[model samples]
Target: MQRRQFVIALTGLFAAHRIAEAAVNPTDPIKIEKLVLSDAEWKKRLAPEAYQVLRHEGTERAGTSPLNAEKRKGYFACAGCDLPLFLSETKYESGTGWPSFYNFIPGRMETKTDFKLILPRTEYHCARCEGHQGHVFDDGPKPTGKRYCNNGVALKFVPA
Candidate 1:
């Protein structure tokens, strides 16, 4: 009973906040400036593999990412628009065969519910370009308890 009430309260609060936010600034999308581009330009900007994942919201093969072995201190950026997505410090070996991060740089990405697989999952994308990055799950490290399962082809690692 308490759990259900708490959930209902949280949902109501979230809806109210979103409504208030829209009333205050309806044009803003998640507080970050949006970037728009032509499909032809996106194809020219990204490689074949990256284009499919970032632009078309496709997933890459698991465990095939060279980024899985990347251990240097740096940040991961969107392959499509070069928007920084995750810092090296937030990354962890989720052992799910993909490069997983505990969190992303705040406001750098946005999320939507994905129903591609029968069960709905949260899908996140680069806020700047709206390029698909990956899905985030609750099973992760202590600090954030989030696993940002990113596609290697959708990201570019930038050393700090």
Candidate 2:
């Protein structure tokens, strides 16, 4: 009985820690000031596909983004707020049919837990606009063992 109580207490502490970490403050260095917009305004400013991906957290079909074949030297910015998120240098072929980057521009993203698939996953969004970009996974190339699997419709490529 004592062992079971200890296990439960430990689990509660871990859950509390996760909750605290997810509650990022606006004043945190990693959190950019937010840009709040009405649904109508967002609809007006973004394309139909971008609106769905950025605002509604919808995923674009894999292998459908021209960015999958993008090879030019440039940066990927959020489709919603044009906030530069990833550099062209960080991109790599993950064979996941989505735009994959190993790293992002510093202080440009915020992460939270997602349970949409009935399991916990780290979901990242643009720090400036809170636009849903994609999920980050542990499998990635050297330098940063993190793959930022982004939805193409949520990004805009800007040539550097």
Candidate 3:
């Protein structure tokens, strides 16, 4: 029947769309200017949680990061590379139980599509070290409708 054929075509189109969404590449291989360490070195350099989050692109549990409560003026840097990723002024209470930021230091991050959760997300990482920081979402405060949801273990706060 025409109805059955139409249904099949629609399903095929939906599948193609999902594939395209997941096809966004993470990062291209290039010579990095900043530090590049082997897996063993990273395991030794970072704490267990930091290594998991930064190196393996793992997310910490919600409401667990002390940075969620951080209110002082400071910079948030990558735990693996110490590259300044965000400023104190950009930090906001997103109520997502994580250290959410409205924006990041320009030129310090690179974004790629992540299909880990089945839905595609714009995941960003440290441009210098290629360490996974977190994903950026559209739901955020004014000026920039981007919420850079970061894992606390992936960053180190430096008080100014």
C-alpha TM-score for every candidate: 0.79, 0.80, 0.79
Give each model's whole-structure lDDT: 0.81, 0.83, 0.80
Off by over 4 Å in 2: 1-31
RMSD of 1: 13.4
lDDT of 1 by residue, 13-65 (tens): 66456534533432344454455656886798789999999899999999999
Ten contiguous residues minimizing lDDT sum, candidate 2: 19-28
Candidate ranking under lDDT, highest first, comes to 2, 1, 3
Q: Candidate 3: deviation at residue 151, Å? A: 0.2
- Give the RMSD in angstroms, all C-alphas superposed, for model 3: 15.8
- Cα lDDT tens digits, model 2, 77-152, are 7888766788899999999999999999888899999999999999999987799999999999999999999999
* Candidates 1 and 3 compared by lDDT, better number: 1
What is the TM-score (0 to 1) of candidate 2? 0.80
Question: Highest lDDT among the candidates is held by which one?
Answer: 2
- Please tell me which model should have the higher TM-score, number 1 or number 2: 2
